[model samples]
Each structure stands twice: as C-alpha cells, then as structure tokens.
Target chain A: MVHNLWTELYIVLLLLAAVVIISQCYITYLFHKYEQAKIWKVIGILFPLGLNIYIYQIIKLEKRLNNFLQIASMERRDWRTAYLLVLAQYLLLFAVFGLFASP
Target chain B: MSKRSKARIIFFLYILVLLCFDTTYSFMIFNLFLAFAALELSFLLPLFRIRNNKEIVMSMFFVVTFILLSPNAIYVVTDLIHLTFFDFDFMEGLELKEWWNFTILVSGVFLALFYYVLMMDQVRAFLGRSKWMNLILLLMIILSSIGVYIGRFLRFHSIHIFTEPLTVVFQIVHSLDYSSVLFIGWMTILQIIICWLFLDEVGVKNGT
Candidate 1:
C-alpha cells in the first residue's frame, strides 16, 4: 500500500513538473511573439531549465504589452498575477510531498 | 556581502554545528569541504580573465580539479544513506533528543541542494555563450549522472581519480547495471530541471 502511494506521489510530482515546464515554455513563446525578444528565445532553447528566467521574461513581457496598448488608450489585464499563483502551487506541492514522504 | 557568500557562510556554520554534535562525521565534512572549495575555485577562475599562456595553464589545472570535484557535490546527496546508521532509540526526558536527527537530515538536504545549485551555475558560467551550449549542457548532464553513480554505488571517491586512475578507468569500462541506468537517467533530467529553476528568477530583465 505504501509503495503504491509512493508511486502515485511520484506520478503527481512528474505531472507538476511537466505543467510548470510547459507553461514556462509557452511564456517564453509569448515573450518572443509580443515583445520581439529573441534573446529569450535563445535562453529558452539554450538554457531550457531557466524557469525563473522565463517567469521574469513573462512579467516583463506583460508590462511591455500593457504599455504598448495603453498608448492607444486600450487597457490590458495584468497577468503578472500568475506569478503569485505559481508560487502558491509550488508551496502546496512541497507541503504535500513533505506530508507523504515520511517513511 | 553578496547573497551567495552569505549562503556559503550559513552552510559552513550549519556544518560546524553538526560536527559539534557528532564529531565522528568529520571525514564526511572534510570531503564535502574539499568539493565546495574546488567548486569555488572553478567559479572564480574565469572571472580573473588570464591572457598569458602560464596563467591559462594554471587555470586549466583548476578546471581539471573542478571537473573532478564538482560531481562530489551531487555525490553528497547519496550521503543521505548514512542517516540509516543513526541510533533512533528515544531517551526519556532528553531535551531535543529526537529532534536532533530531524535537524541533521533537513540541514544536510539543504546543504546538498545549495552546493548542487551553485556548482551548476558556476559550470554554466564556465561554459559561457558557447555556440554549442545546449550540446555541452546535455553532455554535462550525462557525464555527471554517471559520475554520481560511480561515486555512490561503486564506492569511488573523487581523489581516487588521481590515486587510482587506472582502476577508476577500468571500473568505468565495465557494464552498467539496471539501477545505474535508471539512476543516471532520472538524475540527468532532474539536474537539468533544478538548474533551470535556480537560475535568475528575473530572467534577462534590466539587461542582466
């Protein structure tokens, strides 16, 4: 039973990792598309593990997009709030792991 | 005064406290310190930007030492196996007795993670803007995963590369077992993931 739970935990961890990576990669794509930031593309490809870099890029990209739209008097919703959600999810993930990891 | 330096000092202080409680683990701490020092040497060498041939050769020496010892940082994770040896039998009325084991285990995990992240950053910096950076990162992951396996299950220390070079080579020449393959495979992937997460959170903002 414990082995089964551990396996399930591992599966959950893998899924969590996959979700983070996919979202981060998409964020990198958004940066490239909207901000014309080819440097993020280089970093995304070369240092694919730079999640924080991706987050930073996404935040900057959002600000730039908002600024560009604002010149036309159009308002864009702030998506930087996603960073807080990501932080919370990671904290919860660790909490779950700690709860189940005791042998 | 930098954040990294402050983290390093905290790591050492934690180790010192651990040693005070359990002096028998001095050898393990000594081995870890050697690995940490080798990593710092590697990280700092490139910053010097030596142009002369003599200086280049000296830098190469440090690079070799770093390559040999950096795996020891990853290898430190395997030292978690040592926790099984601790006497867990509870003594009544002993203040913070049972909690000591928990403290040691958590601190060791933090320290190992700290070392691994720093070493990975230094290595990426060492590789700096190479055209083949991706390929190099892939190569490092594979090689370091193998290095960790050899260090852990094969009982080979980094110093053995110098003292028993031939034996080390001979052992590595042999076939890899199933566990070694799985260990290497997962470790490589996880190492890359952790490396990505640990890099600057602000990304390339402010032209960093």
Candidate 2:
C-alpha cells in the first residue's frame, strides 16, 4: 500500500515538473516579447537547473539595458519583477514536489 | 582556471589523497574512477555539434555512455554497506575503526555530491535552452535510479554491458519487479530533491 502511494506521488511530481518547465519557457517568451530581452539569453533561462547561467545572462542583459536607458535619457521600468515572480513560482513547485515525494 | 576545470582538479586530488587512507579497498577506488570518467564524458558531451550528422551521432554515443555510467557516481552511497562486513571492536580498534569509517563515509558522500553537480551542469549545457528541460532531467533521474540498482544489487559494473551484453540485458529485463520499481521511484525522488536543493542554493548565491 505504501509502495503504491509512493509510485503515485512520483508520477504526480513528474507531471508537476513538466508543467513548471513549460511555464518557465512561456514566461521567458513573454519577457522577450515585451521587454526586448535577447532571445538567446531568454532561451538559456529555460535550463531549469542552470540557475547560475540564467542569472548571469539576465544580469548581463540588465546591465546593458540600464546603460542604453541612461543614454536614451529614459526611466527604467521594473521588468525584473516579472522574471523574479516566475522564478519564485517554479521554485515553490519544486519545493512542493520535493516535500511530497520524498520517502 | 574555469570553475568547471577547478572542480575537476579538486575532485581528482581529493580521490588521490583518500586513496592513501583507503588502501584496504581497491574496489572503491575503481568505482570512483568510473564515476570520474563519466563526469569527464559529460563535460565533453555537450560540445559536439548538434546540426552536423556525424557530430550528432558522436554526441548521442556520449549521451548513452554517460547515462549508463553516471549512476556509478551515485552508487557510491551504496558502498557504505561494505562497512558492515568489517569487524571492529569499539574499545579495541576505536582509532583505526573511526578513521576508516570517516574516510569511507565522507569520501563517498563528497564524491557523490560533486558528481551529481557535475552531471547536472553538463546536462544543462547540453539541453541549453531546450523546451523540455524539466522532462529531460526527470527522465535522467529515473534512469540513474535503475542504473544504481543494477550496480548495487546485481553487482554489475558499467563496463559489463559491453563484455556481457546478453547477460546484462537479460538481468536488467528480469529485474523489473515491483520492489525494484518502488526502489527506483524513491531513489529518483531523492536524487531530484538533492539536485534541486543544491542548484537552488547556487542560484541564490549567484543571483545575490
């Protein structure tokens, strides 16, 4: 009985992970469309486990974007807030899966 | 040196130092060597050209070999069971016993964690911007769990698949019982959780 329950939990967790990954990709797409972030860096963000790479790429783009805005004499909108929320969503999903599926 | 190369050097040096203290157990050294080889293969696997037909074929071979051997890294945890075979009287052999125990346990766990991180980073590099990143990681974890079982309980090394293909295939096909399924499932969950925690911490540190 316990074994069956664990197996079911595993399946559920796997499905949750799939959903989270798809959503992460979608969020990146949205950011790329509206914020003019580079498509390649946004694509790099899809790597679920490459958090360091993702942060590095995002920071690089943000810094460049800040310089461009400064030269253009424009105010910088808080676009990073959207990306942070998406990250938090996937992270919470991972924590939930870990908590429920651990033996 | 790059972060990845630095890690590889540190891991190699660590194994060398530990080998001095682990003289009684040669198999452990062999297992670690296989794990180290797998990490190196993973590091190289992502560099192949995905667009060129020849390069794609070569990279697929690397991918298959990596999946087959990466579990040897995780199987380090199972090596701790060997400690039960040793006879140690706490009062009589406390010093030697404690030292050996610490060496095995610490090295085993450290190598496992390092290999796990190395594999994850390499795989992410391979998957670079793929839409199915999470699904791929989940599948790799499931396969690694089964591979761990084949290594631990069946006493089959990764190279045995090449030398005794038929016997290895038969054993793996026959071992897919309910208990093994449950075992693999739990192990998959544990491995995923560990990797997630490690990567998340790295993300936090790097992001801040």
Candidate 3:
C-alpha cells in the first residue's frame, strides 16, 4: 500500500516535470519569435538533444540584442524560488522511492 | 591556477589514490575517469571559436560523445547494489574489511556526483542563468536518466550504441515497461535534487 502511494507521488512529479519542460519550450519559441532570431537556431532549440549547442548560438544573439535594444531580461533570482520548490518536491520523491523501492 | 582547475587537480589526485587502494574496484574508477574526461572535453569544446565546417562537425561529435558517456557518471550510484556482496550483521558487529570496502565504494560514488555537480556549474556559468539554461539542464537530466536505465538494466555500454546501434535501439524500445519508467523517474529526481543542493551551495558561497 505504501509502495502505491510512492508510485503515485512519483508519477505526479514526472507529470510536473513534463509540464515544465513543455512550457519552457513554448516560452523559448516565443522568445525566438520576439527576438527575430535565426530560424535554424530556433529549430535547434526544439531539439533537446542538441540544446546546448543551439543555446550557445542563441545566447550570442541575445547578447547582441541586449546591446542594440537595451531590453531588460529576467533576473536569475526570479526563478530561484520556483526551482527550489521543484527541487524540494523531487527530493521528497527520491526519499520515498528509496525507502519503499528497496526490499 | 584558477579555483576550478585546482579542484580538478585535487579530484584527479583523489581518484589516483582510490585507484591504488582498491584494486578490485579499479574498473569503476576508470569508468568514472572516462566519464569525467568526456564531460571536460564537452565543456572545453564550446570554448573554441567555430570558424568553419570542420570545427563545427568536430564539436558536434564531442557533444554526442559527451551525451553517450555522461550516464556512466551516475551509473556508479547503482554500484551500491553490490553492497549485498559484503557481509553486514549488526548482531555479529561490524567487519573492518567489509566496512572499508563500503567506504571505497561510497567515496567513488560521491566523487562521481561531485564531478556531475561541477559540470553543471560550469555549464550554468557558460550559458548564464536563464530559462533556456534550465531547460537544457532538464533535458540533460532526462537523457542521462534514460541512458542509465539502458546501461544498468539492458546491459548496454555506450560503445554499443556505435557498434550495435540497431540492436541497442531495439532493446531500449523493447524494455519500456513500468519498472524501467520508475527507475528512470527515480534517477531523474535524484539528480535534480543533487543539482539543487549544489546550486544552494554556490549561492551561499557567493553570498547571493
């Protein structure tokens, strides 16, 4: 019975991660459109496997955009709390999984 | 030398000492070393200015290699299952040799995790803390979790992806059951929590 509860919680956490990843992808798309970044770079952003490479290219463009447009970007701290909440949820998930998954 | 470089040197020395001390588990240390090397190469590859097609292709090759090997780092954690091989009985009291073996195994695991945390920090510093950066990290964790599942349960090494690509792919697809999903989910969450703890340490260190 306890194992079932942990499994349910694990599924919930996985669902939450999926939602965050999908929403972040959408946000990245919008950023690409607003910035009028290169189409290929944006396409590469959609491919999570090569994300680091594409991110490097997009960040270079963002630096140029920052200089030319003087647009303010979101502070890292703004996302810190949300990230912490996710981390706490996952840590709880890990603890439960560790406790119940072992014989 | 920079602080990061100093840390790398210290870590290397620690690995050497562990290698010398534990002959039976030297292969695990070697695996950890190779994984760390792949990560370092991947991190350094981006530093080179991409001038032409050849450079771009080479960089992509290293990126792929990095992804393939990254799972080995966390795969060491699963080595804890080998603890069952050792004798541990509270009623009989602790055995020094068994306890020593446990220490060596755990130290190697912790070193692997530290390598992972350091790599993440390096990537964050390179990309800057943005939504894109976080997304990339999430993708990496997800990929590594899948990779670990393949490595641990399916018994496929990273090189198998190159030599037996079709077979490896088929096995991975065939092995998609509830237990595999659960294992992958557990690994993903565990990694994220470790990364978060590292981030908190950086914040505290920087007085942010």
Alpha-carbon TM-score of each model against the true structure:
0.57, 0.59, 0.60
Candidate 3 runs further than 4 Å off? A1-103, B1-3, B22-24, B48-54, B200-208
Cα lDDT of model 3 by residue, A20-97, tens digit: 465446445444544465764455346442243325433553254331122223322222222233333333344444
Task: Order the numbered candidates by lDDT, best leading.
Answer: 2, 3, 1
Worst 10 residues of 2 chain B by lDDT: B199-208
Write out the backbone clash pairs for model 1.
A49-B196
Question: In model 3, what is chain B's TM-score?
Answer: 0.84
Worst 10 residues of 2 chain A by lDDT: A67-76
For candidate 3, write residues B1-208 as lDDT tens digits.
Answer: 4434444565677677775775456566666765565445434433332345645654455456667767777787887887887767868987787888777777778777766776666556555557698899889889999998987788777666654578888888998999989989999999999898775454212311
Where does candidate 2 clash, by residue pair? none
Of the native A-B interface contacts, what share survives in model 3? 0.00
DockQ of 1: 0.01
Please give the distance, in angstroms, between residue B114's alpha carbon in candidate 3 and its true position after superposition: 0.5
Superposition error at B143 for model 1 (Å):
2.0
Model 1: native contacts recovered, as a fraction: 0.00
What are the per-model numbers of colliding residue pairs? 1, 0, 0
How would you encode candidate 2's per-residue C-alpha lDDT over B1-208 as one tens digit per residue?
3444455666667667666754454566666766776665564443332545544554465467668778877777667777665666566756675566657666766776777776676676568688998899889888889889887777676656643578878998898899989989988988888887775443211311
